[model samples]
Target chain A: MALAKRIIPCLDVDQGRVVKGVNFVGIRDAGDPVEIARRYNDAGADEITFLDITASHEQRDTTYRTVEQIASEVFIPLTVGGGVRAVSDIRTLLNAGADKVSINTAAIFNPELVKEAAERFGSQCIVVAMDVKDLGDGSGRYELFTHGGRKETGLEAVAWARKMAEFGAGEILLTSMDRDGTKDGYDLGITRAISDAVDIPVIASGGVGTLDHLVDGFSEGAADAVLAASIFHFGTYTVGEAKDHLARAGIHVRR
Target chain B: MSKTVAVIDYGMGNLHSVESALRKAGADRVVVTDMPDAILSADRVVFPGVGAIRDCISEFKRLGCDETLRAVIEAGTPVLGICVGMQSLMTRSEENGGVACLDWLQGPVTRFPQDHRDTAGAKLKVPHMGWNRVRQISAHPMWNGIDDNAYFYFVHSFFVPADQCDSVVATFEYGLEGASAVAQGNVFATQFHPEKSHDNGVKLLSNFLDWDGSC
Candidate 1:
């Protein structure tokens, strides 16, 4: 059997609670992070990702406690992202039992943080999450955006991905701001471009409305993993159904 | 009688996942420690590592866990090594310009060949970072209740060469065959992360806790 393509359910956590956004806006409460994570684990989620959207410093400890509690019972790979700027942040999440930490805005500003975090923690745990929006110009270019896809950095998406991989990023969490919450599908062009460019694993995030989108991700997009939020969170589909669909479509997934 | 399993922590990488998994697997007392006295006296011992092999070896040296580990194994205590923990049990590794290992197992940890392709001609990814079917090659206590060719979560770039390892009990293919699990006397090691592998993994950890370090 080959390496199974991963199915990661993304949990947008705010102060220990799980939230899901519609098209990156219209926030809706899902449930407790620990409870949702356990359900996903029992339903056969390959991995669980927690995006800590805590807006304050004092409540930051809530993310850690959430991670600690889930890790104590979930028994699956846990990835914590959002608001990770420093190496110490990565360390704290890891110490709280996060298997990997995703860095987005920080990597664009101080690329050295990617290098240093990878060097200190190993590339396996340093995931550089890239939020990209297609320029939509006739030039066929894509620009990287940070701050939840509001501000554009003008940095080329594919090049930045290669640079992050060079800086020793274990994986790239490529989220298409344009397709995100649009429920269309992944940006296959950019996904394939980045996946082809980096030898490391690429996890395609955003714009997954159905299981077929996941198949296209691996087959057409060439992504090593697929991350989704609302579809799995709102009970549109279970992690098991997603895997079953992937398996039936000839994409090897954990059964 | 009560059982105490010492999870050797050398400040390498995350051990809480491993520690909590052991507890969930029914270990009466799972102590994560670096003290030789604590490790050697335990009913079972677990050696876990992550990141660069050089750093792992250096930390072992810094903490003087190298000699302590060797002594614990010699005393016939059941030992379980995970990830870099498994690689560090080898004689040497080709990571970080090559690092010497504990040599408890007779082999070298090497990186997957660059540009390796499977039958589909697709270039296999490094770090093998997902669930892959592990084919059990030999019967061992760890395989109890686990199906042959069961999937486990793995995330690593280097692995023990399947051909050179006589003690390989399980293997998985990623363009080229690599050792998934190996056992020698009281020492059992796995390249995958059992703690993160869900139910199958929990079962394996449970079996490890019940293992008497025997075949």
Candidate 2:
């Protein structure tokens, strides 16, 4: 017996509202996080992940109160990420009703943070967030990017993921910076690489243009989960339609 | 008439969405109630959810619907359990360290296997996601308006492994073979969310609605 696959929709919150963009630019107001979560809950999203893409650098905030509003209203489980830098932040998110927290730049800056989060909140509560990109030198090797995909670190993405798993990070949220908002499809090569390197769950994010992209992300990428935007935010593809397409494609999903 | 499908809202589910989906699926009557008789009297029953496995099994017991459900099925009534509700039909489940279930089938609910890779070099991914095809096997009532290899939606971390291969009415291949739908007489369940699955979801429900027991 093994865990079931998950279909998760991501909500990017800035200040106190829901917004989305490609390459993290030209952002558009999507809607209220609470409203967006409610619709996805109704549409059959298994879980919801909130990415505070601005949390790392912005100081215009005191706490993640928006997540509380959305989590309180939604019945499904939730994962909160972005600028999550400390054990207290993890506790705050959990106390605020998040099922997990995704750590990105923080984990890269101090790899030990993953171990500490896992030790404190249990491994299942800590998700190692990895943003990756190709050097474009033609070797097809990927390097880790951090700070909401704005900074590139020379660390090999796959090696860092393996390290996260060893430190007890229960899951991995792998986003391909090159594919962010391209809607072309997921970066299967990056997703497959990390998925193969780790034993925990891998959530493939970015480049979800159509239903087929999601399909390829799950099978070809070997992702335990698929995370998307644009389509979900712009309403090009509803969660239910995505699930049905996956189900018909021979993927196991919650119906 | 509201059609009145009594959805068992046992603290363990996302009953709201299932209810909304039913409404969107042409279900005129949808009520989220756990009163045993309401569940019994409804034209159909839907058990919706997303929560701790332990709390749910206990909630069903507290509401005393365990035997009521057994009676409904004995009377040949139609019922459906989404996610954990679907998992509930199996013998038992292993979660929160360890917990037991209705034993309706005969085994503990377990994680999806990574065996697909070992057997065929198939891709192995947990919490398998996205749109995948479902291959129908036996002629179950849930297949009413749907065809073979039709698609549906899914999201979960665990599944039901049947006591009998015959228990599986439909299956989808991932790294290993995963049971997408299971049937034991009138009791039916799926690993995907029909409410979120669009037309395929509606068709499966409609099939359950039109079942005449001829197959």
Candidate 3:
């Protein structure tokens, strides 16, 4: 049987609470991170990603607790990221029950960290999260962003994705800054590019407003999975509804 | 009394999630322990693992769980191995520069070709993540209530070949046919993570719990 396309609901957590924002700004509290995670788990989400957006060290500890609580309640695979700087950090989250740890800024700072974590924890548990923004200079190329999309790395998105895979990243959480929260759809161009370039699974994140967007993610983008936040968080579409739509569209999804 | 399920912890394995899944699967007393006695004394044992085979073998040996596992298997106690747990059951693995395994199953673990491709000529990813259907090859207790081609979650780069065809109970297509589940006498193992597989996973775990180690 063909492997089913995954539907992942990403929870942007701040201080232990799940939050949502537009264009990575103007954040607003949605609900308790654990509650939302449990809801998604029961609603048939293939997986859940908890992106800890908190900046302070103390609040980061809170994110760890949030991850622990969510992992306890959610049975599906959980991916936690945001401020994952070291192998010890990954170990802490994994010990707390996270199935995979998403590495972003730290991965760029030290690509070896990806290899180290992958070697130590198995590449299956390391997810390299790439935040890509359109160059907008008519180059039609995308560059990587760090610090929650606040800074640009000047590294090409597709190349960086391939590098991460070479460095032993099991999966790539590719997020499009241009399409994030716009609800238009994923940046299919870059998504398909990276998906084609890497031999590891690619999870398309950002800009999923409707079920069709999810279908597009799998079809046009060739993504192995699709991740969204607001659409799932605010009831714009339930996880079951999205899965049903994908199933109807002839995309295999776990029922 | 409900069976006491002991999940072997050699400082590896996703023990927490496995323990939680066992509980959900109706295991009343699930113990995550590295203590060899705790493992041997349990009614059933779950050998779950993740990460590198080099570390897995070292830890398995260092904790002396290797000898304990051998004893449990020799005693015909029902044991379930997941992922690396399943891989380590084989004689050896090409991973970690050719590490030796438990030799419970007469086969070698090999890595999926770096350029592995599906029948459609499409490139397939390694560390085959996500859910895929498992086709049962033979009737076994662990197959109880699970659909013939039910989907289960998987995450691994290397796979154990069904060299000992008699032990293979199920197979899944991922560029090539690899053993998804293997069974022989009182031992059962799966490459997929039943704990992470939701309904199908829970059902499989529950079946393992109810299994009497009889073929």
Candidate 4:
């Protein structure tokens, strides 16, 4: 049997509660991160990505606690990101029960961290998260952004993705700023480009308003996994429903 | 007395999650320890590991775990190895510039070809992360309640190509056929992480807890 395409529900946590926003703005409380994660686990989510949006030093402890709680209850693989800045941060999260840790801003500042983390803790546990935005110059190029999509790095998204994979990133969490929170769909053009450029799994994040959008992410974008927050957060559809839709749409998903 | 399950901790892998899953699977006493005596005396030993093979072997030897583990196997204790734990049981691994392993199994661990492609000609990713189905090749006590071709979570770039096909209990296809699960006497190992595999994983772990080390 072939590897099943994954449907991941992202929990964007602020302080301690789960929050959802559009285009990376206008945040609203969804529920407790741990509780929401448990719901997803029971509903047969392939995996769960927990992003601590606030990611402040003060929130670090709280985030760890939340991850520990969720890990104890949820049996599926859990990936935690957002405040991870160094190897120590990665160690703490992994020790706290995270199966993988996603690195974004720190990875851009020091790509060596990607190599170091992957070398120390097998590449399977290191995820390089790329927050990307289209340049809009009609060049069909996307630029990398940092600070939660507030700062633009001018680095080409596809090139950075290739570099990350070369440096031993096992997976790429590609979040499109333009499509994020827009609920239109994934930036299929860039998603497909990065997925094709890297030899590792690429998780398409930041859009996904409908089940059809998810099918498009896998079918057109060629993403190995599709991640959505608001869609699963606000009850638009349960994870089971999404899996059923994907399965019926001819996309193999774990039921 | 309740059975004592020792999860050999050579300072690698996701020990906590594995221990928790073992507990949830009905192991009344799950001890995560590096102490050789604890592991040797336990009713069953679970050798779980992650990270580079070189580091894992160095630590395994540094802690004198190799000798103790060998002794446990010789004693006919039921042993289960996960991921790197499974890989280390092979004769050698091509990871980390070629590291020698425990040689408990007759195979060499090799990395998946970087340019591996599916039948559709699509480039398959390394690490082979996420869920894939395992086809049962030989029935054992561990396969008790689990369905054939059941899906399990996997996260690895290296796999063991069994030299003896009869030793392989199950196999999975990913560009090429490889042993996803192998068994011989009291020893069992899997390339997949049953702890993180949700229901199927729990069921397998529970089966291991109940296994009597009889082929």
Error of 4 at B166 (Å): 4.2
Which is better, 3 or 4, measured by lDDT?
Answer: 4
Q: For each candidate, give the interface RMSD after superposing the true interface residues on Cα.
A: 1.0, 7.8, 1.4, 1.2
Per-residue lDDT tens digits for candidate 1, residues B21-64, read 99898889999999999998999999999999899989998999
Positional deviation of residue A247's Cα in model 3 after best superposition, in angstroms: 2.3
Q: Candidate 4, DockQ to 2 decimals?
A: 0.72
Once fitted onto the true fold, the runs of candidate 1 whose alpha carbons sit more than 4 angstroms away are A21-30
Q: Which candidate is the best by lDDT?
A: 1
Write candidate 4's Cα lDDT for B108-164 as tens digits: 888899788988888888889999999898889999989998899999999976444
lDDT of model 1 at residue A35?
A: 73
- What DockQ would you assign to candidate 1? 0.80
In candidate 3, which residue pairs get closer than 3 Å at backbone N, Cα or C atoms, i.e. clash? none
Q: After superposition, how far is residue A57 of candidate 1 from its true place, in Å?
A: 3.1
10 residues in a row with least lDDT, candidate 1 chain B: B116-125
The candidate with the higher lDDT, 2 or 3, is 3
lDDT of 3 by residue, A89-144 (tens): 99989998899999988999999999999988999999999999999999998999
Better of 1 and 3 by lDDT: 1
Per model, state how many residue pairs clash: 0, 46, 0, 3
Lowest-scoring 10 consecutive residues by lDDT in candidate 1 chain A? A21-30
All candidates in order of DockQ, best leading: 1, 4, 3, 2
True contacts kept of each: 0.76, 0.03, 0.59, 0.65
Q: Output the number of the DockQ-best candidate.
A: 1
State the C-alpha lDDT per candidate. 0.90, 0.73, 0.87, 0.89
